[model samples]
Target: KSQEFLPPDEALEDPAQIAPGDWTLEQRRPWTGYAPPYAPDLNALETQVARFRRGDSLLVVGAFEPQEEEQPETDTRRQSMNPRIVDVRSRRNESRGERQARSNPFGRIQEEPVPFLPEEPEKTAPVQSGLFLIDTETGTHHEVLGEGPRGAFQLLVPNGRYIIGVEAFSPDDKRAWRDRHGLWQDPLVLGLAAVSDLLILKGGGNLPESLDEALPTAMPVTRIRTGESFKAAWELYGLRIGESASVRIGVDRGGEGFIRRLGQFLRVLEPDAPVVMTYEDTGPDVLGTVFRAVELNLPDLEPGEYTLTVEIELSGREPMVIARPIVIVP
Candidate 1:
């Protein structure tokens, strides 16, 4: 009982003529790649299904169920068949990606435009305080400086550089408040300074007239210390009619031989005007009262309002004139 043997390679190559024991290569194509031999038009079939109104006969080709009972419309029977429904499909957002690509020409993601913020402005420099000037000729260099209220600076030249002096503009070293209250301290050391476009002054060195040219544009600087010196610490002293009131008006630095020289009386004004109060020219008056502290005693003055103005001249500076009024009824 010997069987006829077949070779393996020939059996695999020619599987159609081989027995059932041969392994055949199964080559299958997808259903979507091929079409049915006789398929119905889907669009025409949908149209025919939608035209089924009231009564329409559907011809079942093979093993198809036929329903003679028609679907109900507006039925109010005991068993209400209309069930509540909600659509969860994202049909509205389906074309969002296509719309974004159309607006962005460079294939960039469409984004909201950002707002711009403005930058801060720059600040301006402050105006200068005072101008400085200096002069030199034939090796004789002299510095002439003038300072006071802004209008009182034109007495100085404004075109050159001068060694600026620092000074304090407060009088009454005690910080008292008054109109004539400002003093210039020791000369400050500002090595070498420069000024430009200053005004040229005219006439003599009277501060008011000399500084009138640079009136509105000049800055105030301290040059001279002019104020009331605390004469005797201001103790409440009274002057009786015939008691010979002795008042000191000069600054004597703690009696350390620092005596501010008082040469002659500047002027004598009754109510501000220079009034003539005649006394013996050489010696004291009949009452032993000499004009020392710009002082005078009234032997007989009717008793009313009297203003005493005394002008005292400083050595190498301007004369100081002080005027104060007193009301006498008795």
Candidate 2:
């Protein structure tokens, strides 16, 4: 019998069809493209036998030289390539108006033209001439009137600290005149016994029996908690005879340079958290001893010191201003 030897390529096994423990490479077939499929059972058994030969348990394979876990690498440099996310955090702190101005493709927001209301003819006063005689000693007043062109008038009364006021009425029958502040208009004060001085009245004028001697008093709490309701009591002297009185209460962050108007600040910082105010009469009579109280609904404000400003608007005079310092704590 003749013995025949096969070539190395013919004797080599295909890696795809070989089992892990069954496949081996010889020196003659060192370059063979032969790799066996992975087998966990075969590897575990072989590891057990090796450990037993070394007088160790099979579980020691994981303890002595544990297989390292393969972790996929993440490329953070590639993730930071997006443009919008590059400086996203910094842009968040910008104000809404600033953001709107910056985001606008055109320079500014477009505004629409406002329509004008037609002007009506001015009404002249029906009662052209009126005389007011006030007795300073008794705080009493008497009035004399004539409906005609303004003319010189004379009144002979007991001479003792007396004041006389002349007034012209508007042709419009409106009972009340509003001041510049949209509140009840106060009468013009004319000094006593002056012949040369002329008194010019814009609207209906009255000779008050007694001047309003009461000054306004405001008592505001110094500190308030967030989301709490507080009362600001104001004592006003002499009459609540007006359509309505308005009180405006505003808050500002302390030490923020110049303080801004409440509406302006609310339009920027807390658009939804508006400056709230409520008005009520605490007076005994409609035309005497006016006592007013206002309520303020505080929002969730940051813990800090703040300045509170109160503006009281009565029959059309300049609004009275009151300011108080307050604190909000956690």
Candidate 3:
């Protein structure tokens, strides 16, 4: 058998025609005497060229012509490769059934393995009524629950002093704290310890310098010359039965004369109660201006209608009251 020889330059010019498995060349070859050269070992051929046994076809590029097929509509919102529409409504409906399967009276979910990539979640954490932050140092690791990804972000740290600091760098490209520490040679430290049952949290996403130092006492309530009052409303859910409902009142805008204390008769008649109420406070700067919450439980009444009443009190002034009726079926 004889083979045709072509230089590497000629092979490069029309490599398609000379390349093995060329459909056009194979068709032209005399079928009677022609046999394919010894087949190259695929393992070796694959290293230099792709392991394609089929003939190569040329993709013709015509003149710059308009596309015959209309370009598919591009939806920017649908760009996500793995798109999913989550209907929280259906999940909420099945949530009850899922919860029944997982939870018992002992405050523990059933020992079932978590599902793999569940489309609709059946259970979620019950929404709480107040801000409650678990103390990280207290060795208390409370599991956060809720449907949203950021559900656990609102936890309130226990009451205590906390050092508050913000990230900063000196203009000279050095850590300000580190430079100061090097100069003093004394260990630079920020004190952070929680008091018993009380947690102090640093606000504005800042670390503290000394947890031992209390936050500057808010300006006294007597600083404001003119005492003012304002009406506020809140919706509350999940009031355990027979729990004391004591709500602190505060003004949203007043400078100093805010914070009135008032609450409904506390007593829960049934399990899981919700209510809406209105309260009033003297201006800002009072104790009630910033945090105004109430706690109440009406035990005598069966799990049903609840009319929440708010009585706002001001310093050296007559008490102004607002009443809002709330109903809790379950």
Encode model 2's per-residue lDDT on 203-288: one tens digit a residue.
11232221111111111114466765555433344333453555666666762122334431222223332365535423243543
Order of the predicted models by TM-score, top scorer first: 2, 3, 1
Q: Taking the candidates one at a time, how many backbone clashes does each contain?
A: 1, 12, 39
Model 3 CA RMSD to the hidden true structure, in angstroms: 32.7
- All candidates: TM-score: 0.16, 0.27, 0.17
lDDT of candidate 2 at residue 299, scale 0 to 100: 74
List lDDT for all candidates, in order: 0.21, 0.32, 0.22
Note the residue pairs that clash in candidate 1.
166-188
lDDT of 3 at 237: 19
Query: Model 1: runs farther than 4 Å from truth?
Result: 1-296
Q: Which of candidates 1 and 2 is the stronger one according to lDDT? A: 2
Among all windows of 10 consecutive residues in model 1, the one with the lowest summed lDDT is 42-51
Candidate order (lDDT): 2, 3, 1
Model 1, span 64-148: residue lDDT tens: 1111222223223311232321121233664645543442222333233211111233242211112111221122222212222
1-330 in candidate 3: lDDT tens per residue? 111112233334432222211211111212221211221100000000111001121111000101122223333343333233222234455564454334211123323221111124325432111111122234332222222111111212233211111111121221111000000011112221101111112122223232122122111011111222112223221222332233332122211111111221221212233333334332333211122323333333434333333433334433333333322233
